[model samples]
Target: MTAEIRLFPCLTDNFGYLIHDPATKATASIDAPEAGPIIQALEREGWTLTDILITHHHGDHVGGVAELKQKYKCRVVAPHDKAAKIANVDLRAAQGDVIKVGGLLARVLETPGHTLDHVSYVFDSEKALFAADTLFSIGCGRVFEGTYPMMWDSLLKLRVLPDDFKLYCGHEYTASNIKFALTVEPDNAALKARAEEVTRLRSENKPTIPTLLGDEKKANVFLRADEPSVAASVRMKGQSAADVFGELRERKNKS
Candidate 1:
């Protein structure tokens, strides 16, 4: 059976997700940005909180963990990296680990870049990827604790996923990300179309998430850093893809 997913806004731009398995009635919060919205969503959906799958140690991501755990007595799963120091973790997962939330299974992928202990969860059967912080709709998280090359490597991990996989990211930065993306590939037809779509979505106050990996591969310049066209756009024709990606990231930082 397919899992039921709920998306809601939390703490300004952060997006909170609830993945529920109908067969087992097991529900897991992807990350707890805050307890209020998650609690409200649980109440609205009539689903008991069974687990919390944390992606990183960021405050906005883990801020609600304590309260939610106290309320529901649910399992809290976090990265195995002791350095992350996330509180109330019941299970610590590493790369290639498979976490079972009732009948649904999520494979763990170590995708550090925005932070040293960052990870992303992939529900292969569901074609869903919860890539908090590391990957966004049209952009990626900043290389705060890792090297640019390391960040590029992390992006590559997610990039290799099936094209049909649906990406559920951490924040609502698509509008801004698209604006910056246009500077790198103004002539890209797919990007231009996506820009228009993003404009319409934001105008309607709708979420631009659950984007297909295929669409991102075609329009997101960050994901296309290895492409010859992307290299030419940044005037780094012969440079390695990692260097080109670094240049693109630097430009995004200043944008």
Candidate 2:
């Protein structure tokens, strides 16, 4: 059976995701921004939390881990390479590790741009990725701990996934990301179309996540850094794709 996903708002712009495998009856929470909403969501679904998957050590991502663990006794799975920095970790996972949530399996992909130890979980059976902050609808996370090359290399990992994969990122930053992406690729019709859609979604107080990576490939500037058009738009023409990616990230940082 395919996993059932529930997306809910948490801690202002941050988001919380719960994935439940019906066959196994195992439920996992991807990054807990706060305990109240996660607990409430679990109660609402009548599902018990079996696992808490963490992407990084950021407070907003893990602030509720302690509380949730205290209440549910759930196992906390975090990045093995950076486990020392994160507290209350029960399992340390890295790239190539496969974690089973009941009958569903998630393959961990180390995506260290937002943070050196950030990891994204991909469930091939569900064609879903809990990307946390590494990737977003129209942009990516800031390069806080990893270098531009590292971030670019990490993003390349997602290229192997099918285009139909749905990306579930950490925040509700699509509207703002679209504004910055427009500055990078103003002439991109797909980006323009996506921006209009995002604007309408925000106008209606709706979530704009769960976007297909195929659409992101066509519209997200960060994902298209290898394109000559994107490189020229950032004045990094004739440069390596990594360099273009760095320049685009710098522009977003300044934006």
Candidate 3:
């Protein structure tokens, strides 16, 4: 059977996920911002925290790591390159590493863009991605530490996944992002439709994560590196795909 996944939103827009396997009584937390909400969700669901998976080292992402670790004594997993950034790490690996949560397994993806230590956890078995901040609902994370090319390459790795894969990202920034998407892809019927949907979501105060990858490919302006419209929008005086991606990212940052 598939794992039971519960999302508990913490901080302003950050999400902490609980992946539970009823058979083995194993549970894993994708990220921890503050321990209180995580503990609350676990208690509400009657699940023990068996492991903690860290996606990055940003304070908003890892603020409660020490407290959670102390409380659950859970095994902590993180990217090998982020050792200097993350506080504690019981296990570490580069991209393409797998960490099993009972019957389910999550593949490690080194998605450095939001931060040099950033990563996104992929579970092809279940078609879910704990895309910390690199990939959001309609928007992507701001470039904090990694180069634009590095971030674009990281997102490209994820773009090839199955179209229907459930994209569970870290924040809820769909409405505004899609609105900005239209500014760049004005003639795109799919993008306009998505913008309307996202606007409705925000108006209703609804959740906007776990968005579809196929949909992102159609609506996410950043992922459309080859699209003439996006390419034109990204074109500086004159540049390449990497430069275009960076330009698009900067435009999104202001939007």
Judging by lDDT, tell me the better candidate of 1 and 2: 1
Best model per TM-score: 1
Best by lDDT: 1
lDDT of each: 0.95, 0.91, 0.83
- CA lDDT of 43 in candidate 3? 96
Please, what is the TM-score per model? 0.99, 0.98, 0.94
Task: Report the error of model 3 at residue 140, Å.
Answer: 1.2
- Candidate 1 shows a clash count of 0
Regions of candidate 1 where Cα sits further than 4 Å from its true position: none
- Clash count per candidate: 0, 0, 0
Q: Write the per-residue lDDT of candidate 3 for residues 51-151, one digit (tens) a residue.
A: 88889888878888899899999888877874457876898867888898777788998899888878788888788988889998667889988899998
**What's the lDDT of the predicted structure labeled candidate 1?**
0.95
Model 3 weakest 10-residue run by lDDT? 232-241
Identify the superior model by lDDT, candidate 1 or candidate 3. 1
